[model samples]
Structure formats: structure tokens, C-alpha cells
Target chain A: MMNRKILLHSRPQGLPTEDTFKFEEAPIQEPEEGQVLVKSIYLSVDPYMRGRMNDSKSYVPPYPLGEVITGGVVGEVIESRSDQFSKGDKVLGMLGWQLYNVADADKLQQVDENIAPLSAYLSVIGMTGLTAYFGLMDIGRPKAGETVVVSGAAGAVGSIVGQIAKIQGAHVVGIAGSDEKTDWLTKELGFDAAINYKTTPNMKEALEKACPNGVDIYFDNVGGDISDAVMTQLNDYARIPLCGAISSYNQEEGSDVGPRILTKLIKTRSMIKGFVLGDYADRLPEGAKMLGQWLAEGKLRYEETILEGFDRVPEAFLELFQGTNIGKMLVKVESTE
Target chain B: MMNRKILLHSRPQGLPTEDTFKFEEAPIQEPEEGQVLVKSIYLSVDPYMRGRMNDSKSYVPPYPLGEVITGGVVGEVIESRSDQFSKGDKVLGMLGWQLYNVADADKLQQVDENIAPLSAYLSVIGMTGLTAYFGLMDIGRPKAGETVVVSGAAGAVGSIVGQIAKIQGAHVVGIAGSDEKTDWLTKELGFDAAINYKTTPNMKEALEKACPNGVDIYFDNVGGDISDAVMTQLNDYARIPLCGAISSYNQEEGSDVGPRILTKLIKTRSMIKGFVLGDYADRLPEGAKMLGQWLAEGKLRYEETILEGFDRVPEAFLELFQGTNIGKMLVKVESTE
Candidate 1:
């Protein structure tokens, strides 16, 4: 048997291109003790991956040159050498871009597909869900009647955040790259208002108008000018959960400078916090339980943009930068059965 | 009786000048049914006052043109009508830059001078003390063995913050403008190390050397280049209590841009919160009790640069901008006797 994988060809200078990744094929190996041979079903391609492509110090280390890029992957265990995993068991874990992964059984989390779709495990019921949960509840702490403006609102993490804020009785406003995304957020996700950042030349004014009352909680995923606009509309004692700065993740160091926010912070007596999902690893089960309950109760809705075939992985990853994905961007390598 | 007062003659453009203030004399009035005639003994000239001189929206409204600038003042109730105040009682309240104030007795906090010195009510045991206590304990939340770096370490609030962090058993490092201030922080206040920001050519390197372990909490008072240097040395999950931005108070709008801190916050999963002392008004007694205990136990010491005479109020206020004051800068308007 053969295993096809994607490798980090080179570190990106600015935005990543096709040349940044390299394709490889290797002989499938047998699972050693406490290991499983898993066939990849779905692969998550997120904006945070852009940071891993750069050769700089960050919360997580950069992807090494000529190494298989590893990320959140949902797979089916075809063969297991450990009692923790079994044949035909669906699982989720950090695995390489390869179609077939020989991973430690202990690292693989068994997934029950009957609860929700397999892709949801890599998204709404997975890391993205937990990211929104902790970043909002733990940091943002949205109170009833508070206005929450979510940047990158149509994305996986953001869409969940908006829904969570709404569930918490907050007035939700979303900012997205396209009118389609804006429509989906406002019409489908029940967002109070949605600002299409691409069409809105005056984002600050648009946000100010959307949030008649100043923004109390700003869920920042797309930083840069979007964050600058949001900063201007923050209310007194506003909380900003800085989930990601995807806008500047692809840019070179020191090239992107946000507006002087300290003055605004002082004026409003606000708080800005930056965090990652992995930081709340210990409490992820709690977040997942809550998200699952919300999903089962139909209080939380999710969307996904799926690309078929393993070769489309790089294309799917690149689409994130172009703002093509409405929710979670996932690439299907093989059928679950 | 004739009352000598200082008025905001003109708004400052870049830095405040002597011409910005106008001295006046007014006839002292008798106490009304609910008011008391308090003779100002000590007047606090804080850096936050610089923001009040500008015509802009902030936590507090700007100082009105040609009006007596009001601030935290320690006074003695010479005459009273309301039972809340008594003759010869030491009090603390928001009073104008004048010799005598006929203020409502209900608004005054009758401070016991026996607990500490009368001026200590204006410095370590009053608003300044409360600012450090809440900002550090509530926002910064410095744990034992953590490294706490305080900017404007020689100022009214910063000096107390360093001492409080010490009481919490943290490795305290201070950043101040002058070598004298740095020496006082380390030699007098028990700071682990001190960085003379004004003289240090490479502040980031100097800070790195001072804080061998990365900074866990940054009590920011002077928030310009000094803050930028501190941000570079911040450890993961660092907390920054944004107390004041004295460095930018004098500069014109858009002239003061600190380095992009959002990226740093993201990299370290850090947080920055701006707050005022009034936010914790109800909890003042709790902090006061703790501070008083520390003062009594000799764990906390306070210093003040007293500019004698009411006419020196403007000069004393200007001294803050020049970084001349070692600790709390005050104008002794009248002798305690």
C-alpha cells in the first residue's frame, strides 16, 4: 500500500503560494505496539496555519522545511495494535496531511459519528468550537443585552462565537469579507446585523451604525484594519478576545502596525486578551460537552466548505486566505466506510 | 479671608507651559447648611491631570477652560454645618486648586491622621494607594515568584505598585526615567532590579537583563517607548494593568503610536486592561486596610516630593512631565497646624 502526503516545501515570505508545499508518496507501514493505521477522512485547513508557515517565534513552533505538515485530521482506524482503538473506529487526532497515518492509539480520540457529521468533529465539535467557547465565556464574558461584534464572522470559529453570544442573550453583529457571508450570518445564524467588510469602505462607521450601542465584546479573528475599526467602537469596560490576527499572519514581521490602542483602552477602560485553543486543553472536554448540548438542542448551527480528494488539500488551505470558505474549510481524503 | 486659587488659563498644545495656568484670589465664603469650609493642606498633581487639560472625550471630562482644576486634595475641615464633618478633622475629597473649599460634607471622606501622616491620606493610603492595589491585585494578579515590572516606577502609583508586588512575593523590577529614581527603587524600595529608561540606549536588552525570567505582570504608568520595551520581555500569559500612559499625555493626537502590541499579546497569550481608581471605589476600604497593615508592619514605605506653598502647584504639576519627582509629587498648600 502507498501513502500520499503534503510537506512544507519552504517558509513563506509573505502570503503562501502553491510552491510553499510539496507532494510526496511513501510506503504504508504496519502499526507498532500501541499504534494504529488510520485512513484520513477529513483534514482541517485553518488560517492559523499561515503562522506555522513563517520562520519566526510564536505561540507554536514554525513548520520545519521538507516535513509533512501536521494538523487536525479525522480518520478511520483500519487496523489497530492497541486496545484503545479498533478496526473501523472513527477517530480524531493531530495527524499529517498523508492519506494514511500510523499514529499512537493514545493520541487518537474516538469519535461517534451518530451524534454529528464527521467534519463537525474537526470544526464545531472540535478545536474551533472549544476556541469560541473559552475565548468568549472565559475572556469576553458577554453579559445580557451587551453588543458583541465578531470579526471573520462567517468562519468556523467566528460563526460559533456569534451563535454562543446570541445564546447568551447578546446583540450579535458580524463582519465578513463578502456579502454572501454577511447574508448567511444575518439570515441563517440570526446575527442582529452583518457588515460586509469588502463592500463597507467605512468599516468603523458601518460598525458604529450596526452596533447603535458601542461594542461591549469584540471577537477578533481578522485583525489589521478590521480590528482598528472595532477598537474605535468599543464601549467602556469592553472585552476583546483576540483569537487570531489572520490578516497579518501571512505578512512579514513589523510590517503590520495597528493603531495606537492604549489611548482608546484608557478612554474606555477596556481589556484586550490574545489566546489559543490549546491553552485550554484541560478544559476542552467541558467546552465540547456544552457545544454538543447546544448542537443537539438546535441552538448552535454550523457550516462547512468541503473539497474532495487529498490533492485538493493545498487548494483548500489557500482558499482560506482568499476568504472563500464560509465556515470550516475541510478536505476529504477518503470515504468513512 | 482671601482664598488663593489656580485656574486652567489655557489648554496645552504639546507640553504644558507656565502660561497655561492663571492665579486668582477669591473671598472665602461661609459654610452653607450642608457644606463645610475645608482648608486645603496637600494637593495631588497627577499625570492623569494632563489628559484633563486636553479637549477630548475620556474616562473623565476635560478640565473646563478658565475654571479651577479639581483633583484629589487632602484638607482639614476648619468649619462645618453638616454633622458628617467636624472642626479640625482631616479629610480627603475632590477639591479645586484653591486654599479653601466650601464642599458638600457628604462627599468628603474623614481620614484619621493618626493611622499614617495627613499627607499619606493623599499618597499611600488614599486614591494613589487604591489605584496600585486594585490594578495590581485585581488585574495584574501577580503570583509569588513571578516577575513584575513597573513603568514610571518612581511615580505616585508605580512606587506603591512595586512595593505591593514585593509584599505578594514577586521578583520586582522597576523602569524609571532618572538614575536617582532607579536607585531609589532598587536600594530603598527593595526592587530586584531597576532600568533607567531615559539613559538606557537599548531598553529591550536592558529589560531582558533586569528580568532574567520573562515579565509576568507589567504595571504600566509611563506607556511609550518604556512600555514597548516591557512588551518585548513579556512571558506567556502575562498580565498588564494599564494604569496610565503619561508618555503620550502631552503629545498631540496621532503622534504617539506604541509598537504593535496585539501580535505580542497573541504570541504570549497575554492580556492588557486599562482601569481607573474610581472603578474600585466600593472596594477601597479593603485595599486601605491591607495597605495600612503593610505600612504598619514596615513592609511598605512611601516617599513624597513636597513643593511648599500653594503658588508652586503649577510648578509641581510641571515637574511630573520633567520626571523630577522621586515618588508622590504634591503641593503643600498650607501647614498642618
Candidate 2:
């Protein structure tokens, strides 16, 4: 059988283009001792991957030139040569943007399809949801009756962050890019208020009006002007868990400039902490247990926007910057079926 | 007895001028049944007092137009109607910028001159020292061999912060406005390196050379371009204690702007906390004990710039922005002697 894979052809200076990626085909490799050959089912496309494309220092090393682009993958094991797994076992591992992969058996975790859909392993119950859980519960620490603000409110991590804030009995406000996304947040996700930043002429005014009592906790996913507006409304001793900055990811390195917040912090006696999901690796089991409990109790809800076919993988990733997805963006590889 | 007091005549738009203060004469206030009359001796002119001059909400109420400017005062309790204080008691209280103040007995803490000089109550063993103690120990938490950078390094809080960091075995680097101040930091205060920001054409480069290793803790006293430069050199999991921002105190409200720090914080996975000494009021005795012990062991030393007469109180305050003092600045009320 033949396997197809996408590789990084070039590193873009700003926003990536079509020429930045390349596709190639090869014969499927055999599983050696203590290894498994897996057929890919679903691939996760995250905004954080954009940071890895640049040749700079980050939480993870930059993606090198002409290698299989790597990310989260849900697959079925077709051949196993180790004691860890067998044929027809559904699994989840950090694999690649490829049709088939030969990986170490110990690295793959067996996931039961009977529990939930295979794509859910890449989203709400996976890294994205855990990112929201730890950042809000650990750093943001939203108290009851306190106002909590979420930026990029319609995206994967942010949507879950708002719902969790609601569960904690906090006054939840969201900021999104489109009117429909804002409506989905307020109407479907139970957000108290949501602002369409694209349509709103004055973000600071809208934020002040939405959070009348001032913001107590801000879970920031998209930092820049939206964060600047949210910062002006922080109450005394406010906590900000800075998760991501999709707004500044594609720009030139030193071009991300704005009005400084040091004086404001000094005046309000507040704090801001920037973190990544890996920082809480030791507490993953605790987070997963809570997320699963919340899901079973109907205290949490999630959405998925899946595109068909492995050929459309890059398009799914590009759509993240376009703000076209309502929740987690995934690519379903139809070739495995 | 007669009293001469300074009032906030007009709130300046930027730098405070002579027209902003009014000198007035009035009869000394008499102590009530539960009060004591305090004759002011050494009065503190601090950078933080500048915030009280503006008509804005802060940790304390603003200095109202045409009223005595209130601040820290070391005094002698001359007359007492309450049982708490006696005729010859040396005490410390928050009193106005005037010759005499009538206050409740419970509001004053009797200080012993045998421990240190009376001016020490306003400097190393008092509020200024406590500000450094909690900010560095509680927030910065510098580990052994880590690099600690402190701005405004020759001022009251900054000098104490640098010495405390040195005691913790951290590689301490200081940034000051003048060569003389920088010399004092490295030569006398045990700082590993010192950078003269006013003379250095490239501050970022000077900081890079001074701190060969990236900074692990930053005790920020003066915020603006210097802080903007310091933020670039932070290591992973770095902690910043935002103590004061004297650089931006005189600018218009919105004019205190610079390159935003959210993206950098995210990349470094760091944290910044803004705090005041009042937040740790319950732990003041603990901090004071530690500071006094350090002074006795010769681990900590301090200096004071005393303007000879109470008439120069405003000049002593204005010299703070001019960087004219090597340590704590005070107005000595010669008439009280």
C-alpha cells in the first residue's frame, strides 16, 4: 500500500502561503519490533502550530524544513509487533499530517470508540479542553459573582473556558470576531454577553458596557487590541491567564507593539501570568477527570467543525486564522474508511 | 504654638511646579481627650506621594485641593491626653507636611531611638524597607545563582531591594540614571553589575552586557523605556514584582505607553505582580524584625538625603524626579528641635 504525507517546504516570514507546504507519496513501512503501523482517521489543526512554523525560540522546537508536519492524530492500529496493542485497536497519539505512520507502540494510547467519537479525542477531552481547564481553574481562579472575560470566545479553548466560568457561577462575557459567533456564544454557550469586535467601532466602550462591574478574571486566547481593551476594565487584584496570542503570531517578531500595561497594573495591584498546556503536565489526570465529570453531568458542551479528506488538512489550518470555525477545527481523513 | 503647612493648591498637568503648593499659617490644633499632639521632626518626601497629588482614585485618597499634604512623619509626642503616650516619647505616624499634628493615641507607634537613629524609622527599618522586603521575598522569590535586575537602584526601595537580593545569593544587576549612583550600587551595595542608563546610548545592549545570564527576577521601581528593555531579557518562569513606576508618574494619564508585554510574557511563560506594602500590613512586624536583624549584622546599610529646613519640603519632593538623592529623601523640620 502507498502512504501520503505533507511536509514543510519553506518557512514564511508572515502569514503562510500555499507554497509553504509540499505533498509526497511513499510505500507504507512495516512495523518493526515494539512498533505499530497505524491508519490515520482524524487530524487536529491548532493555532499554536503557527508558532512552530517560525524559526524562533518557543515552548517546542521549530519545525525543520522538509519533514512530515506533526500534530495530534487519531488512528486505528492495523499491525502491531508489541505487547501494548493489537490489530483493530483504536488509538490516539501525537502523530503527523499523513495517511499512515509507523510509531512506537508504547507512545500510543488506546481509546475506546464506545465512550465517544474518535474526533473528540483530539478536542474537548484532549489538549485543547485541558488548556482551558488548567488556565482558568489554576491561574484565572474565577470566584463566584466575579466578572470573567474571554477573548476569541468562539474558538476551541475559549468556548470551553466560558462554559467552565459559567459552571463556577461567574458572570461570563465573551469577545469574538463575528456576529454569528457572538450569537452562538450568548445563545448556545450561555455566555451573559458577547461582543462582535469586527462590527463594534469602539471595543473599550463595548467592553466597559458589557462588564459594568469591571473584569475580575480575563482568559486571553487572542492578545493585541482586544486584550488592551480588556485590560482597561480590570478590577483590583484581577488575574489574567494568558493562553495564546493568535493576533500577533503571523506578524514580524518586533512589530507587536502597543500601549504598555505596567502603570495600570501598579495602580490596580493586579497580576498577569502567561502559560502553556505543558506547564501543567503533572496534573493532566486530575484535569481529565474533572472534564469527564463535567461532560457526564451535562455541565459542559462542545462543538466540532470538521472538513473531509486528508488533502484539505492545510486548508483547515489556514481557516483558523480566518476565524471561520465555531469551535475545534479538525480534518477527517476519508482514505482510512 | 503656630503651624506652617503646605497645601495642594493646584494639580499640575505634568511636572509639579511652585504654583502647585501653597504655604499657609494657622494655630496649632489642640489634642482631644483621646489624642496626642505630635511635633513633627523628620518628614518623608517619597515618590509614592506624587500619586496622591493627582485627582484620581488610588490606594489612598487624592490630596484634595487646598489642604495639608499628608505623608510619613517621625515626631516627638509633646502633649498627651490619653494614657498610651508620654511627654518624651519618640513616635512614628502618618501626619501632614506641617510642623505639628494632633492624632489619636492608637494611631501612633512609639519608636525607640536606641535601636537606630530617628530617621531610620522613615527609611531602612520602616515603610520603605518593608516595601522591598515583601516585594522581593514574596513576589520575586529569587533563587541562589539566579540573576536579579533592579531599576532605580540608588533610590530608597531599589537600594534595599538590591541588597536583599544579594543576601539571597542571586547575581544582582542594577540600573541607575547617573554614574555616581551606579558606582554606589556596585561598589558599596554588593551588586554584581551596574548600568548607567542615562549615559548608555543603547540601554538594551548595556543590560545584555551587564546581565550575562538572563534575568530571573525583576524588581521594577521605574517603568517606561528601561522596563521595556528589561522585559526582553527575562528567562523562563521569571517573576517581576512591580513596586513603583516613578518614570511615568508625571506624564499625562494615557501618555504612559510603550511596547506591549503580553506576547513576551507568553513566550517566556513568566508572571508580573503589582503590589503595595499595605497589602502585607499584618506581616509588618515580621519584615521589620528581619530588616533590623540584617542592619545589626551589617548585611544591610542605608543612606538619607536630608534637606535642612521644612521650607524646602517641596524642593526635596521635586528632587526625586531629578534623581538628586542617593537614598531616602527627607525634609528636616528644624523648628521642632
Candidate 3:
């Protein structure tokens, strides 16, 4: 049989383009001892991938050139040579963007599609869910009646965070790019309020009207001017969980200048903490358990923006920068049945 | 008795000038049923008071126009109407910039001059020492072998933070404005390294050379460009205890813009927290116990730039912005023989 894969062709100067990815084909390999030959079902494309394309030191190393792009993938074990994974089992792992993957059974975690769909593992119950869980619960520590303002409120992680904050009894406010997103957050997700950044001329005034008691916690995903606006409204002892800065990801380094935060920070006595899900690697089971319980109890809800076909992976990844996807952006590869 | 006090005549557009103060003389106040007549021996003029000069809201309300500026004062109780205070007792309280103050005995904290000196209560054993202790211990949480970088290293709180970090066996580096201050930090206070920021052309390069292990904790006292440089060298999981931003204290609001820290903060997974000593008001006794033990053990030392005479109060306060004082700046109002 034949397998198709995608590789990092070259690093883009600004926003990544079509030339950044290269297509390839190879003969499918058989599963070795203690391994499984898995057929890819769905792959995730996230904002953090932009940081890896650069040749700089971070929490994780930068991606190497001419290599299969590594990301979260949900697949089916077509052939298993290990006792851990049986044939036809659904599994999830940090695997490459390929049609088929031959990986060690130990590297893949068996996921159940019985509770939710196969794409749900890559969205609501996987890394995306865990990222929102730890960042908000551990860092934010929302109190009942306290105001929580989340940037990228309609996006995957932010959507989960707002729902969890609501479960904790916090008055949640969302900031998104479109009126549709704001309406969905307020009407469907039960957010206390929502602000459309594209339509609103003055966010500070809108925030003042929305958060009458002042912002107690800010879950930052799209940083820059949006973050600068939120910083001005922080109440005393406000907590900020810094997850991503997708707005400035394409701006390059040293040029993302804004108002210095030290003054307002000192004045309000606020704290802003930058974190990734990897920071809570040891507590993954705890987070996953809570997320599962919440989902089963119907206390939590999630959204997904899936693209069909493996070839549309690069296009789906590019759409993240344009704010075209509302939730977890996933690309479906093939059918297992 | 004639009492001399200064009033905030007018709010300066930027930095306070000679025209800001108005001197007046009134009869010394008599102690009421719950009050004590105290003679002010020494008064403190700190950088934090500058924030109060503006009409903006902060931790405390802005200093009222045409009113006496309140600050730390050490005085002698000449007359007592309350059972709490006795004659010849030394007490400390937040009192006006005046020679005599008639205050309620409940507001004054008794100090033992025999343990240290009269000025020591206003410096090491008073709010200055407590601010350093809590900001470093509670927020910074320095571990042994960690590299700690302190800006405004020779000032009141910065000097104390360095000594405390040294007691924890951390490698401490200080950034100050002059050779005299830097020499005092390294030669006297036992700092591992010190940088004269005014003479150093590139603070980032100097910091890199001084901190080869990268900065684990940054105790920021001076903000603006100096803080921007410190932000670049933070190691993974770095903790910054934001104490003060004396660099831009004189500049009016909204113009102190610099590089945004979100990207670097996310990359390094660091946390920066701004705090005031009031945040630990409930634990003042706990901090006082630790500071008193360190001082009695000879593990800590202090510096005070004492300007003689009550008339020099405003001059001493103005000198704070000029960076003329190496440590705690004080004005001697009177001597009790």
C-alpha cells in the first residue's frame, strides 16, 4: 500500500504560505514487535505551531527543516504487534502529519470513540481540553461572582475555559472577532457578556460597561492591543493566565511594543503568568478526569471546525491566522470502516 | 510651641518643583482623651509617595490637594492622654510632614531604640525591611544556587532584597545607577556581582555577562528600559517580584511604553507579580519576627542617607528622583537629648 506525508519545506518570513509545506509519498511499513500500524483519522492544527517554525529557543525546541510536521493525531490501529493496542482500537499520540504511522504501542494512548466521536479526542477530550483545564483552574482560580474576561473567547481553548468558569460560578465575559462568535458565546455558551473586537471601536469603554466590578481574572489567548485594553481594567489582585499571543505571532521579534505593564501592575497589584499544558504534565490524569466528568454530566460543552481531506491540512492551518475557525481546527484524513 | 509643616500647594504637571510646597506655622496640638502629643524626630520621603502626588487612584487614595503629605515618622511622646503611651517613649506612625503631631495612641507602634538605633525603626526594622522580606520570600521564593538580579540595588528595599537572597545562598547580581552604589553592593553587602547601569552602554549585555546561569528571580525597583533589559534574560520558570518602578515615577501617565513581555513570558513560562506591603498586612507580625531575628543575628545590615533639619524634607524627597541617595532617604526634624 502507499502512504502520503507532509514535510516542512521552508520557514516563512512573515505569515506562513503554501510554499511552507511539501507533499511526499512512501510505501507503508509493517508493524514491528511492540508496535502498531495506525491509519490517521484526524489531525490538529494549532497556533503554537507558529513558534516551532522559528529557529529560537523556547519551552520546546524549534521544528527542523525537511521533516514531517509533528502534531496531535487520532488514528485506528489497523495492525497491532503489541498486547497494549489491539487491532481496530482507536488511539491518540503526538504523531506526524501522514496518512499512516508505525509507532510504538507505549507512545499512543488508547482513546474510546464510544463516548464521543473520533474527532472529539483531538478536540474536547485531548490536548485542547487539557490546555484550557489547567490554565484556567490552576492559574485563574476563579471565585464565585468574580468577573473573568477571556480573549479569543469563541476559539477552542477559550470556549472551554469560559464554560468551566461558568461551572465555577464566575461571571464570564468573552472577546472575539465577530458578532456571530459573540452572540454564540452569550446565547449558547451562557456567557455573562461578549465583546466583538472587530466591531467595537473602543474596547476599554465596552469593558467598563460589561465588567462593572472590574476584571478579577483575564485568560489571555490573543495578546497585543487586546491585552493592552484588558490590562487597564484589572481590579486589585487580578490574576492573568497567559496562554498564547496569536495576534503578534506573525509580527516577528522585538517589534511587538506596547504600554509597559509595570506601572498598572504595581498600582493594581495584579499577577500575569505565562504557561503551557506541559507545565502540568504530572497532573494530566487529574485534569482529564475532571474534564471527562464535566462532559458526561453535561456541565461542559465544546465546538469543532473540521476540514475534510488530508490535502486541505495546510489550508486549514493557514486559516487559524485569519480567525476563520471558531473552535478546534481539525483535518480529517481517511475513513476507517 | 510653634509647629512647621509643608502643604501640597499645587500638583506639578510632570515632576514636582519648588513651587509645589507651601510652609505654614501653627500652635502645637494638645492631646485629647485618646491622643498623645508627639514630637517628630525623623521623617521618611520615599519614591512611592510620588504616585500619590498624581490625582489617580491606586492602593491608597491620592494625596489631597493643599494638605499635609503623610509618611513614616519616628517621634518621642512628650505628653500622653491615653494609658497606652508614656513619656520618653519612641513611637512610629504614618503622620504628617511636620515637627509635632497629636495622634491617637492606637495608631502608633512602639519601637525599642536599645535594640538598634532611632533611625533603624524607619529603615531596616520598619516598613522598608518588611517590604523586602515579604516581596522576596512570599513572591520570589529564591532557591539556593538560583541567580537573582535586583534593579535599584542600593536603595532601601532593593538593598534588603539582595541581602536576604544572599542568606538563601543564591548568586545575586545588582543593577544600580553609579559606581559608588554598585561598589557598596558588592564590596559591603556581599553581592556576587554588580552593574553600574549609567556607565554600562548595554544593560542586556552586562546582565548576560553577570548572570551566566540566566536570571531566576528579578526584584524590580526601577522600571522602564532597565526592566525591559531584565525581561530578556529570564530563565524558564523565572519569578519576578515587582516591588517598585521608581524610574518612571516622575513621568506623567500613558507615555512609559516599552516592549510587550507576553511573547517572552509565554516562551519561558515565567511569572511576574506586582505587590505592596499592605498585601501582607495580616502577616506583618510574622515578617517582623523574621526581620528582627536576621538583624539580631548580624545577617543583615542597612544604610540611611540622613539630611539634617526639618526644612530639608521637600529637598530630601526631590533628591529621591535625582538618584542622589544610596539608601533610605530621611529628614531629621529634631533631636531629643
Candidate 4:
């Protein structure tokens, strides 16, 4: 059978263009011992992928040219040569950008679709969910009645961060790129206030109006001027979880306006801590179980911006940088059945 | 008896000048019911005092114009009306920039001059020592064989920080403002290496040469480009204790250079924590007891830049911002005898 795959033709210099990737087809390889052939059902298009496309040292190595673009994928095991995975079982693994992947069965986690939608496993109940869970609870440590401000609040990881802060009885404020996403955050996600960063002329003033008590916990996803504005309103002993800097991820070179709040941090006696979801991989099951329980109780709500068809994965990934995705950005490769 | 005091005559716009202060004399007041009249012997000139001179909101209230500049002082009780203190007893308290102070006896800590020198009570065996000890141990948490880099490495606080890191079995690097201070750090303080920032063309390269493995714990006393350079060399899970930002303390307005290395912090998955000695005031006794033992055993060495007379306190403070003082800056008001 022909297996279609998206390959990294060249590393991106700045923002990635469609030309950076190439679509190619290959013969489906038979699953060797302790391996399963996964039919890609849903693929995650995330902001962190931008870092992997750069030829620089990072937490993980950069993607090599001519290799399949690496990413998280939720799929079904169509064929298996190992006792670990069974045929027709739903699984989530790092299967990259491909229609069919011969993956090690040990790397895949069996998923129960009855608990939630299959796509949710690649988002809210997956890496994005765990990223928000550990980054907020372990680092931010939002206290009851404390004010929490989240950047990229309408995006996948941020949406969950706001909801989790709200569930913990915190006054949550969200900063998003559009008015529509802002309304959804406040009206549906139970956020106290939402600042549409695109329309907001003065973010510092907006934050002041929304959080009068000053931000006690800041879950930073977009680290540029938005972070600087939020930092000025931070209360004494504030905890900041530096999850991602989506604002600067696409830039080829460093900006003149870097994170300008270090002196303010010293003055307020606040803390800024950086973290990644993979760092806490050992505790993923613990985070997933808690998130699963919260989802069943309807205490946590998530939104997904799905782009239909495997051919449109690059377009979906591009839309993430443009802030076009309302929630977790995902691309559908094939039907679950 | 005539009591002399150094008062803040005018608010400093930038760097404090001689005209910023006024020396005045008045008749010494009698001790009230719960008070004791103490004669000042050694006065501490700290960087935090510069913050108190500005008319702005801070952790501590700004010192009013024409008021005695606030600071910690080691004194001897000349007259006592309270049971808490007795005549001829040496004590340490916030007696400000004055030759005599009528303060509540309960506010003073009795000191044994025989344990160490009386002046050491205001420095190495006192606040500066405790600031370095707790700020490094509690916040930095350096592990054995890890690398530690300290800014203002020859200053009162930073000097102690490098030594303490060495005691904890970490390879310590000191960044100072002069060649003399750098030599003192490496030869006298037992630092592995010392960088004279004034002579060094590139701080990042100097840091790279000193710490080949990258910095694990950074004790920041002077914040600005030095801090920015040190931050770039921080390893994963590095801890930074933001003790003081002496570089920016004298500036009336904020600098244009925002913390340019904050993005590096996220990439490195490090932590920057701001701390004040006052926050850990309750635990002072614990740190003091330990530091006292270290001093008595000759495990820790200290240097003092003693400026003669109470009138030299303002000049001594100005020297701190100019990076002229080596180790702790003190104003010797009178002989203990």
C-alpha cells in the first residue's frame, strides 16, 4: 500500500512557509517484531514544532532535512506484530506527519474513545492538557482567590490553563488574539475577564482593569510585550510559569524588545520558572487521570480548531502562528473506523 | 550630650551627591519607659538604602527628606529604662545614620564583642552574611560539583555568596568591577576564577571560559548586562537568587535594555527568584548561628571597607554604586571602647 508522508525539505529561516515542506509517498513497511502499523487518524499542529524546524540547540534536536515532520498523532492500530498492541485498538503516539507509521508498540498508549472524542486525546486529554496541568499546578501554584492571567488564552494549552485556575477558585483573566475567542473564554470557560490583545491599545491598562489585585500567577505562552505588560501588574511573590514564547518562536533573530520584566521581578520579589511537558513525562498518567476526571465532571472545557484532510496539515500548522486557530489546532488524516 | 545625625537633605535625581545629605547636631534625648539611649559604633551602608531615598512605592517606605537615613547599626547601651537592655551592653538594631538613638530596647539583639569583633556584627557575622547564606542556600540550592557564578563577587554580599557556594562543594566563579577585587576573590576568597568585568571585553566569553559546564546557581547582586551575560550560560534547571540590582538602583528611570535573556531562561528551563532579607527575618537566628560558627572556625573570610566618621556614610553608600568598595561598606561612628 502507498503511505503518504510530509517531509521537511528545508529548515525554516524565520516563519515557515508551505514550500518548506514536501509531500511524498512511500510503500507501507510491515511491522517487525514488537511493532505495530498505525493508521494516522488525527495529527496535532502545535507551536513548539517551530523550534524543532530551526538549526539551533534546544531541549530536543532539530528536524533533519528529508525526514518526516515530527509531531504527536492519535491513530488506530491496523496491523500488529507485537503482544503489546492489538488490531483495531485506538492509540496515541509520536507518529510524525504520515498516513501510516510502523511504530514501536511500547511507545503507544491505548486510548478509550468512549471517554472523549478521539481528537481530544491529541489535545485537551493529551500533551497540551498535561502541559497546562503540570505547568500551572506544579509551577504557577495558583492559590484560591488569587488572580491568574494567561497569555494565548484561547489557544490549546492556554484554554486549559484558565479553566484549571478557575476550578482552583482563582480569578482568571485571559489574553487572546481575537474578540470571538475572548467572548468564548469569559462566557463559556468561566474566565473573569478576557483581553483581546489585537484590539487592546494598552495591555497594561487592560490588565489593571481586569486584575485589580495584580496578577499572582502568570502562565506565559506569548512572551513579548504582552508578558512585559502583565509583569508590571504582578503582585509581590507572584509565580510565573514560562511555558512558551509563541510570539518570538517564528522570528529568525532575537527582537530588540526582549522580555523586559526581570528588574520588575526583582522589585516585586516574584519568580519566573520555565518548564516543558516532556520534563514531567513520568507524571503524565497522574495528570491525565486527574484531567480525565475533571472532563467527565464537566469542570473543564476545551475547544478545537480542526482542519479536515491530511493534505492540509501544513496549512493548519501555518494558521497556528497567524493566531487563526480558536483553540487546539489539529488536522484530521483519516476516519477512526 | 550632643547627638549628631546624617539627614537626607534633598531627594536624589540619579546618583546621590554630597549635597543630597545634611549633617546636623542636637541634644541627646532621654530614654523613655520602654526605650534605651544607645551610642552608635558601626553603621552599615547597604544598597537597599538607595531605594529608600527615592520617593516611590517599594517593599519598604521611602525615607522622607530631612529625616535621618535609615540603616542597621551596632551600638552600646549608655542608658536604659527598659528591663530588656542594660547599661554597657552592646547591641545591633535599626538605629539609622546617627551617633545616638533612643529606640525601644526590645528591638535590639544583644551581642558579645568577645565572640567576634563588634563591627563584624554589622557585616560578615551579621546581615550581609545572613543575606548571602540564606539567599544562596534557600533559593540557589547549589548541588555538589555544580558551577556557581556570582555578580558583584567582591562586594559584602556577593563575597559571602561565592564562599558559601564553595563550602557547598560547587565550583565558584566571581565577576567583579576591578582587577584588584578579582585577585582578592581568587587568592583570598578561594574562588576558582574571577573575571574583572571592567577589563573584560566580552562578559559572555569570560563566563564561558570560567564555567565550561555552565552555571547551575547564579547569585545576582549587580543586575544589567552582567546579569544578561551570566543568564546565557545557565544550564537546565539553574537557580538565580535575585538579591539586589545595584546597577539599576541609582537610575531615576528604567533602562531601555529589557532583560534580553529572559527567552534564554525559558529555553534553558531555569528559575529566577527574587528575595529580601526581611522575608526571612524570622529565620535569621538559624542563619546567624551557622554563619557565626563558620566565622569562628575560619571557614569563611570577610573584608570591610571602613569609612571613618558618621559624616562619611553618604559617601560610603555612593561608592557602592560606583563599584569602588571591596567587601562590605561600613561607617565607623566611634570606637567601641
Best by DockQ: 3
lDDT of 4 by residue, A1-337 (tens): 7999999998887788877999999999899999999999899999988888888767778899899998899999999999988999999998779999999999989998898999899889999999999999999998899999999999999999999999999999999999899999999999999999899999989999999999999999988788888988989999999998988887754453554455677778899998889889799889999999999999999989988889999999999889999879999885333
Tens digits of lDDT, candidate 1, A265-327: 987899999999988989988999999999999999999999988999999998998999999
- lDDT tens string, model 3, A111-208? 88788888888877888889999999999999999999999998989999999999999999999999889998999989999999999999999999
TM-score of the second chain in each model? Answer: 0.97, 0.98, 0.98, 0.97
Report how far off residue A314 is in candidate 4 (Å).
1.0
Residue range B88-158, candidate 4, lDDT tens digits: 99999987688999999889889998998988988898889999999999999989999999999999999
Which residues of candidate 2, in runs, are more than 4 Å off?
A335-337, B335-337
Docking class of 2: medium
C-alpha root-mean-square deviation, candidate 3: 1.5
iRMS, all models: 1.6, 1.1, 0.7, 2.1
Overlapping backbone residue pairs in candidate 2 total: 0
Taking the tens digit of each residue's C-alpha lDDT, what string does model 2 give over A182-288?
99999999999999999999999999999999999999999898998898898889999999999998987767887778878888889999999899989999988
State the lDDT at B182 in candidate 1.
90
DockQ-best of 1 and 2: 2
TM-score of candidate 1 versus the correct structure, residues matched by position: 0.96
Score each candidate by Cα lDDT. 0.91, 0.92, 0.92, 0.89
- Give the runs in model 3 whose Cα sits over 4 Å from its true position: A335-337, B335-337
Candidate 1: residue B268 lDDT (0-100)? 89
Better of 1 and 3 by DockQ: 3
Over the true interface residues, superposed, what is the Cα RMSD of model 4? 2.1
